[model samples]
Target: QQTPASYYFTEKKAAETRIQPRQKFSHKGTFGHALLVAGSFGKMGAAVLSGKACLRSGAGLLTMHVPACGYEIMQISLPEAMTTVDKHEKINTQLPELDAYSAVGIGPGIGKEQPTVELVEKLLDTIGVPLLIDADALNILSENRQLLDKLPAKTILTPHPKEFQRLAGDSSNEFERLEAGRQFAIRHQVIICLKGANTAVILSNGDVHFNSTGNAGMATGGTGDVLSGIITSLLAQKYPAEDAAILGVYEHGLAGDRAAARRGQSALIASDVVEYLGW
Candidate 1:
């Protein structure tokens, strides 16, 4: 049985790895650069929210690429993060080079437009680092099932039940849900994070780990977007895919807990969760 504690990550130590303490002089690049491709014409807030939360999560640098329409809004809302515009203003098609980014995050407010489908497929095929797919990007993948195996190794997929059903087919119960996630992860050589109460982190080794944090209050808009940002930021910092997902869920939910304390879950908005990210 996969217990909640199964989500605990084992620390990895390497001799060749540089161990810089907090007191040491580390540069911004010491963290990492995260490429976040999100948002569309009407869904600018999604991009802004994810970018802000990622920057807050301590990503060394964040570059958000959105539709041309969201370019100005993103730049204006997030001064700390960089912005780039694609050929289309709405992310109709085409993504930039995958090799240029340390980690990649897609989905979030991205609509399921047919052209965007082609772009998502291309990114799945070409991205060479840890990849995170959320929101409509998962929807796109469901439509393009053939591209599932093309995802890069150690990719982290953040999907709610609906999105999980699309990628992993269907599951009648939590046990079946886990089984599907397990098979999918092993088959694709990626991580599948099925988000819910006791969120499951399916690993490439066929182990199913479940998170203990989070509450029902987190079931709101932009909350999942925040999770995607946190996981992507952790991945940018070189954490393993499963580690990033587990820690990200814990931290993201912890942030939500803090926000709920202040405003109560009834009043809690997604922005409140991001506001409490300092926790």
Candidate 2:
């Protein structure tokens, strides 16, 4: 008897085993650098979670570019991470030099002042590598839709439904929402991970993979930040964008589930997911 395809699950170990490849003699330099730009006044938790998740996902070196005010908090909280203190207390209209990093993640807890929007545009214009974009970065894109076409090919954009609607234009229903996601990916020459129930990851070539590992417990504020980290790490480790989106989304949801199992859904924090990254 044929079972419903929606009834199946992609096991956590299945993704990890399939996606984690090998090197004959790997070194610290082999894994590649990941740069994360995150944090703001009340949202420092996003920065903390993303930095930790990147390390857990095995990025060899990480530098978090945050606003000046977050410098001491970030450094004290995560000693292993290096930071760039943008003097404006928030990342303003200046674009950081991104040439060194293999992968980048941005937009977690980034507030949308006018200058921040300009900085986002500058980053999109200047960055030459794959990116995992989230949060207010997606918001900034929605505000300025033309920036979508200018994004680097192979970049990964993680947007929740509201953000997805803003970036891809409004959707009247679920089917339209997904079609909008797929079209945006192809048009931008990148990957789109619309995070929600049965999270849909659409690629530039018109492939869509719906993930089934997460639950409503992961709807917390910092969950997307952790997801941004996972995809950033995967890209830094040289996973193709599609595989990274598929596998990273799977593992991220599973990690959230693991956190929920231990802490219960009500108390399942985003940090718990990062803590269980090794489990």
- The model with the greatest lDDT is 2
The per-residue C-alpha lDDT of model 2 at residue 44 equals 79
The 10-residue segment with the lowest total lDDT in model 1:
10-19
lDDT of 1 by residue, 39-70 (tens): 98888888888888898787889999888888
Q: Candidate 1: lDDT over CA atoms?
A: 0.80
Candidate 2 residue-wise lDDT, 55-96, digit = tens: 888888899888887889889998988888787875534567
- Candidate 2, pairs of clashing residues: none
Question: TM-score for each prediction?
Answer: 0.90, 0.91
Count backbone clashes in candidate 2: 0
> Which residue ranges in model 2 land beyond 4 Å of their true spot?
1-14, 22-24
> Which pairs clash (backbone N, Cα, C closer than 3 Å) in model 1?
67-89, 68-89
lDDT of each: 0.80, 0.82
